[model samples]
Target: MDYKYLLLVLSLSVILILSTAQHENIPYEDVPDICAKCVCLTAHDTDKRYHHLLSCTSKKFQHILARWPEEFGKKHDNVDIVATFSGNNIELLQQLPATNATLTFSCRHCGIKYLQAPTFMDVPFIRRLDLSWNEIASDELTPDVFRGPYRVTHYESIALVDLDLSHNQLHALDRKIFEHTANLTKLNLSYNEFRVLNAPTISALSSATELQELDLSHTAIKSLSAAIFKSLVNLRILNLSGNDLTSVPDKLQLIGRSLVSLNLAQNPIARFTEESFIGLKSLQRLNISYMPVLKTIGKSVFTRLETLKRLDCSHNPKLVEFDLESLTHSSNLTNFDISYCALTTISLFVNVTQESHTDIATLAKPWPHLHTFQSIGNPWYCDCDLIQTMEYIGTEGDTKINQARCDTPYFLAGALVSNLSSQYICNLKIPKQYKAILEEPPRFLRKRYIILTVIVAAVVISVGVMLGFAIAAIRRRLKRDDFGVEPIRYTSVRSSNLSAFSQGNTNSIIVNGNGVANASA
Candidate 1:
């Protein structure tokens, strides 16, 4: 009886364990009190439709269930497109609501650590998903991380368009990580710890052939292979800024025909040769700014980007030489920023009536779309050589003249190039040696010259008066000697008198033939 009773007790325990496990898996009917404040949205565009939104942003919600609240899709079946969950502390994402309604979903800054496979498998209409600023990595991930849920009644692949995984510690990825999503377009993986994009990872994303924009900025990638982006022929925008790339890869020619925008700023690229961007004909906006190590850009570097409209080369203190003529090939170039380069001069895209002179109005015709040109923070020489450039910028009125300052000849230092007087430039046209004399010197120098002249004249006049007195005394002595009786010299008396007269106290003097003077005080 004891044995039979023990078996019954063990059987009951097993039944109880199964029951508790089953209960946890079932979806909850009532909304959690914490999530009750989420705003259920209504369609604003149509006014008749119900479009729902569930925002639990920054709510510090710790866990999510394996299934959404029961009947959430059925009750609000008319709703479409739920979007945005910013600044939350959600740690785990196990599942998503089973509906073709959600179009956009963002869980940025959520501190998410674990995300179960098939998280978005049931939601077939997710267009945009942002999981940025999380602690997501590939170590805890499986090959089927994006696989859809099993035993699904509805069957369709998720129509995910945009995905942002930026600011995460995702250093590696599985080969089949993105295999399920074929229609992904814009993918941003910036601010991550990707050391290199290997062949397996590149192959995984190659299925997304319709990709338009891809941003890998601030990722520490050191090198690239040609086959990495060969499949993305239709890619339009590519941002690889803030990396350790030494040179641009030749593989860029693969998407050269369709690519539009490229950003490689904040990198340590040493030079930009003719082959740097050779085949990118359709490229428009190019940003190569903040590259401290960049020093040289070849003359024909930009000759191929015929559709380029904007180019930013700012904050490169070592880059001194630039060939603006290379940009003339890209007729659509409109916006240009070459600020903080410590440049002394630059050539524009106009014919010279005077040598090196640019006529902004005449040049504006060929490049009708060219409008903004920024050259600020450069050490400009504002002498006669730059007068034409200054005059053109001032007259065009449409051109933007950033705070380009003078840095030469002491007098022009710290003064703005635009504010320089035209009269000063005209005077500078004369030879520099002659121009100094023609132009009035600074007031301090003039005062110094005047004081020195007065001191020299006073010294010369005093010497002249002393010489005149000495000559008159010598002539009187000679006349006395000629008219004397018996040639009496009176040498001793004259010597005493002359010695006393030499002193300024002498009141009277008598001179005899013996070169002496007698004085009475």
Candidate 2:
């Protein structure tokens, strides 16, 4: 009788153990507002939920959905428990409350390109998305793949905002596929194997009219045409870093009202010509950093960026110089970096944080609001050439330098010239390095000798020449005056005794005739 009672007690205990295995359904009232119909066992009040399960945040859930999951009505009444996708488990997506999806993921071993099919709509709550890392690559797209927002079966309005398809092995994307995501705000297509993008692809994005931020970094886009970004008029932030862009065409007329930030860092854009930044009037920050081969800055290359605030060009080793004079007039520039370029000194007619010329004593007018300036790895010649600029910079504030040495002029290298001497500038370290240009003690003896020699030589030569010429002229004039008169010669002689002869002719004709004959003879 005791054995029978023991057997009945063991059966009752087994029945109670089976009853414990059943799940106690928590009422809907106990769930957070975000998880009323959702099966999240742990959702805080801060959890977000949309009429269409907008996103699952704050809680980790393993979702499980059948390939042919039943849909009850406009609101999905049936969604399974979230589960992990493992090898032994049947391949399945969790759930979708929408009718379409743009599949983008990468799973190399499984040979899955992307699972962007309407079959995912049978899962629950997903409309648009980013499948960045799962291996998924498909070339041909059936018409069923492009049936997300176009189908009016689900809602009066679609709930698609952003899509990211980076890190996938996608080689071909039909440009027409973007029309289905008209409501998307941001699209990330970076880190893929796209050598060339057809023009119609960007144009289709323009037709979308809502894409704000587009990241096309790490593409092999070799060059840029005029209308490459023509369709993206409303794009506010564009990231084109890590590409092969050598230059930007002039036809890139990006309007000011829409664009604010442009990041083109790490491209092989060796040239920053005047027309490089043509029509971007309202740009605030421009990052062209880490470009390995960018060698130089063109004159007025950044002229059109009137509203620019920050310009970063820090890591281009071949960039040897800059034009500081042209940018001295710019009032909007505040933060400027040109570190690691082969800079020798800070002269005028380039983009700079200050009017960075050397050897000037004081500022005619200081840049009262300029913030930072970077000039390192340059050949700094600390002669009379850089005294004034060095002094002015030291007076204004400390200019930070790193691993830079002045390389020239037989002396004064690695010796800090920023504050060595105002009057004299010599070997910047030895004997306190004082040897001035204009305001040192004069060598009176040597200067006097030189001055006297020049003055005496000039006066003596000039006086000697003048005196020689004057003496010669005076001698010639005196000789002409003294011997100017000429002597004249004349002939003399005669007598007339005709009257006396005539009067005595009567008395003494014979004697008068004889006397007249003698006189005549």
Top candidate when judged by lDDT against the true structure: 1
Q: In candidate 2, what residue range of length 10 has the lowest lDDT sum?
A: 22-31
Candidate 2: regions farther than 4 A off: 1-112, 119-128, 138-157, 349-370, 382-410, 415-521
lDDT at 136, model 1: 89
Report lDDT (Cα) of residue 513, candidate 1: 88
* Predictions in order: lDDT: 0.72, 0.54
Candidate 2 local lDDT, residue 477:
96
Candidate 1 wrong stretches, greater than 4 Å: 1-36, 47-49, 65-78, 149-156, 349-366, 389-395, 420-521
Q: What tens-digit string does per-residue lDDT give for candidate 2 at 246-342?
A: 8764555654567778888888777787778777877877888888888777788776777777777777777765655445445566666766666
Native-referenced Cα lDDT, model 2: 0.54
* Residue 299 displacement in candidate 2 (angstroms): 1.6
* Cand. 1 TM to true fold: 0.72
Alpha-carbon error at 299 in model 1, in Å?
Answer: 0.7
